[model samples]
Target: MMAFSSVTEPLRAANRVGGKEPYSWHLISADGEPVSSSSGFALLPDFAITSSPELSHVFVVASIGVRPDRNAPRAIRVEASSRSIPHRPR
Candidate 1:
């Protein structure tokens, strides 16, 4: 939740400052269902990845439950996008 909020709040603040909705985002899940955060809060996604639109940017944040090792879901942690998104392991 912290990671997601950290990325989004800035865009929200930008909209508030500009007095218009200059940035828009959609919540997406692999299955198009509600995903649970580390705090157990549920977020309903707008689209499933297979059905997603042409996005200008895609942020695939692995949940706290995921392991960053080789066993992690290949589709989730896309290698190409990972170059832009930093990885912090615990």
Candidate 2:
């Protein structure tokens, strides 16, 4: 999951309803470091893409105009392709 969206909080809140729903979520970033949102809030990712396991679903969330360049370092491409993750630009 990404840090800039309210999706995480809503999901967490829903889980508190107390059912059989399983909440297995992880926050990740490009450099395995903390990222600052456009709103100036900061969050640390749980893992870096390169070190993460091959996930069935991967979501890359970035604000509009904040998308990473396609010509970014090879490491980013490798990680994206390795997991078949979709690049959701904004």
Candidate 3:
């Protein structure tokens, strides 16, 4: 999972309910470091997208922005799929 900053709880819940154990779910960041969410949560990625092996799926979990806010970056969406990776966001 590309795991953009939010939706970690829901993803974990879905995996638990669906019984789909990730062979290896890795957290990734643009800088190979930690990212903070709008909701005050912080995530420490396991690797940087540029360095990780190609994945079957990359999920970008971003919350709906405030009225004056903008959407998640286009690059994040593009990067998720550029390497033949399927993207899912929730």
Candidate 4:
């Protein structure tokens, strides 16, 4: 949540200063639903992993204790890998 807010808040601040909305974000989940954060707070997604929404970049915010299979369903992750979606595991 901090990572999301960190990036977004700055973009929003920039927009406020520049007078034009230049940055936006779309929260995505594996199943097109809400995902619970590390703090157990649910975050509603704007799209699903399979939706293939047009994007300049995709940031999979995996934190400590976040399992890969949970962040993204294994099958969907494999499918996305087959399509060559860029992702780096930390």
- Please tell me which predicted candidate would have the highest lDDT against the true structure: 4
Winning candidate number (TM-score): 4
lDDT of each: 0.71, 0.66, 0.61, 0.74
Give the range where candidate 2 is weakest over 10 consecutive residues by summed lDDT.
Answer: 64-73
Q: List model 2 lDDT by residue over 6-85, tens digit each.
A: 66676677788766556556777766887777676787888876887656665556774564645335667787777776
Per-residue alpha-carbon lDDT of candidate 3 for residues 1-90, written as tens digits (9 for 90 to 100): 223423466667777888996544687776577766667677788887667777766664555552322333544556666776555567
lDDT by residue (33-69, candidate 1, tens digit) is 7877878898899986656676677766765675454
1 or 2, greater by TM-score? 1
Error of 2 at 73 (Å): 7.4
Candidates in descending TM-score order: 4, 1, 2, 3
lDDT of model 3, residue 16 = 88
TM-score (C-alpha) between model 2 and the true structure:
0.64
lDDT of 4 by residue, 17-38 (tens): 9999877778877778888778
lDDT of 3 at 44: 84
Which residue runs does candidate 3 get wrong by more than 4 Å? 1-23, 66-90
Tell me each candidate's TM-score.
Answer: 0.69, 0.64, 0.51, 0.72
Give stretches of model 4 more than 4 Å off: 70-90
- Cα error, candidate 1, residue 40 (Å): 0.6
Q: Quote the RMSD, in angstroms, for model 4.
A: 3.0
- What is the lDDT ranking, best to worst? 4, 1, 2, 3
